[model samples]
Target: MIKTIAAWIGSYADHPDPRSALAGKIALVVASNQPFYPLYLHWIVGTAAWPAWLSLLSTPFFLAVPALARRHSFAGRALLPLAGVGNTVFCVKLFGAASGVELFLLPCALLGTVLFRPDERLKSAIVAALPFIAYLFVDAHLGEPVMMTSDYARLVALNGMSVAALIALIGLLCSTQLATREVEIVTTEIPGARQHVDISD
Candidate 1:
């Protein structure tokens, strides 16, 4: 069943790197969106504590993941910072402190390197990390609980989403850096010079 499912999904996941990246994006989107379903169920049943808009507004950030996987420069460049800031703020607001949900900021920050080309990585990385960096500078010390309504169940759900998102991004990072060049090695006339190895698609 596993192999069969892999084969089936392999059609959409064309290349190895993209396959991994796509998996990560899908996992992020699913994880971010997952709570909405349950929350909506409770909302319908009139038992939800959290407002629906809190999660609803975050949809665009996750939705950008697919475009990033497609190598859309705008999406890759814009999304990391957006998600990082939005999620980090939400974490502090919802839990009234530095909750573990803020952990996803690291992976989102690293996406600057993983998702973009060399030319864009630095700028992307700076943007991705700036929000968290600014937060550290402004609110260096913890304040009194702001939204003290967070419960154990909510914490578990938020942490679980962060873990799942991190695992997916890690998988993307590890999926056999498809050699951008051939396997053969050659000598160069210049001392300490590296030979350029040609790669095929």
Candidate 2:
């Protein structure tokens, strides 16, 4: 069953409608951002209903730890629900009106990369591309009506960039692992006679 799923994901490289794979990622980012925007608005306008301390402590642990653990399956699969719980706590506590959309991208991408086989390059490419697309739309929407302070906006952008970079890095590392695994598999399977194939030939 696992092998079958891996084979299907691997087949994505040959699929025609490449964009469909990225659709879910794009939707998640856009939808999450909508609610997050209003929260930022409240924070900027000084009408933020929630206290800063309530968010400051919990949000980081909830978002960061799972994100870190998500690079490996054993811990990551177990911790994802915990991460979701943290996200829920944050959403309820910080309830003003901002899209916490940015928060989910890294986690989703990390989860996709870790849970799926590394040979599914198409899926990995889609996962990597979605965050970049989401950022462009989010950046464009961050003007005028949703008036955030320049410093705050910069901070948010920087954080998003950092998370995106981290996701890409994780993807690259996973790809390397997959390549190494493939090479090991091939080397081990090579017949003794064929193994003597010379480079000069």
TM-score of each candidate structure, all chains considered together: 0.55, 0.38
- Residues 1-201 of candidate 2 have per-residue lDDT tens digits of 999965653443221222222222222333334345446545554644234334444333333332343343333332333443344334333431133335545555455445434455564565445545554444344343222233455435534664575456545645765675676576678865335544324
Model 1 clashing residue pairs (backbone): none
Model 1 spans with C-alpha error above 4 angstroms: 1-48, 65-74, 138-146, 150-161, 172-201
Model 2: how far is 148 from its true place, Å?
9.1
Candidate 1's displacement at residue 2, Å, is: 17
Q: Which digits, one per residue and each the tens of the lDDT, describe model 1 over residues 1-201?
A: 989976654443333344335434443544456566436334332443354346456666665554564575446446645665566566555445434555555665555455555676566666756666746763344455343443545554655675676657565444544432222223244443343332222
**Predicted model with the maximum TM-score:** 1
TM-score of 2: 0.38
Model 2 spans > 4 angstroms off: 1-76, 81-103, 109-113, 116-150, 192-201
Number of residue pairs clashing in candidate 1, backbone atoms closer than 3 angstroms, sequence gap of 3 or more or interchain: 0
Error of 1 at 12 (Å): 9.2
